[model samples]
Target: MEGHCLCGAVRFSAPDAKDIGVCHCGFCRRWGGGPLLATHCGTSVSFTGAERITVYASSGWAERAFCSQCGTHLYYRLLATGEYFIPAGTFESNDMVMTSQIYVDRKPDYYAFANETPMLTEQQVVEQYGFPPEDAKS
Candidate 1:
């Protein structure tokens, strides 16, 4: 799938992308105003207008990026593996299924999705992904 930032300042293509994973972590909510509906594009995403991308190191192990021009969220990337979780809304067209949601325990009760998808708590996400412990700071 191919897509670009709101102002067309950053364009990207995620080859063979499929599943859309929802992240309800606090950081994601504070960053995007709600849960992050993103696709795990791994390391196969290609980008254009890279110079217009601004990145923020949101955590010790991951960084989030956006278009410097429009402030559109571009991706949340894992530093060590170069895996990218690009926002689903960024895709021009997609038929990807919403398979799972992470950080479900942190999700506020004000909103909820109608989709019946598997959910994982913060601890489950960390353990499944083999992320460093919260106290590790990296």
Candidate 2:
């Protein structure tokens, strides 16, 4: 899959994507003004114009990056496994499929998705990931 930053300053390619996941975690929701639709591109992503990207440590295990020029959210990357969960909208095509959602309990009642994907609550995400609950923080 091919994608680019909002200002075209950074371009990236993922050899393949496993699945798309929605993160309803408060941090994710606030980061992009809503849930983050992320595509799981496992550790094979390459980048061009890498110098223009700025990374912020969103959690102990992951960092979220964005293009400095345009403030476009780039990717949410796992620190240990190097796996990438990129924002789906950054891609040039809409081929990724949503399979699951995390922090479902954190999602507000004002909006809902009709996709009927399997959802996990904040506690469930922490259990499944076996990580600290920082990602579930509001």
lDDT of each: 0.90, 0.88
Task: Find the 10 residues in a row with the least total lDDT in model 1.
Answer: 129-138
Q: Write the per-residue lDDT of candidate 1 for residues 31-90, one digit (tens) a residue.
A: 999999999998999999999999999888999999999999999999999999999999
Candidate 1 segments exceeding 4 Å error: 132-138
Error of 2 at 23 (Å): 0.2
**Candidate 2 lDDT, 1-138, residue by residue in tens:** 899988899999997675789998888988999999999888999999999999999887889999999999999998999999899899988767889998898889999988888999878887988867754246
Query: How many Å off is the CA of 117 in candidate 2?
Result: 0.9
TM-score per candidate, chains pooled: 0.93, 0.93
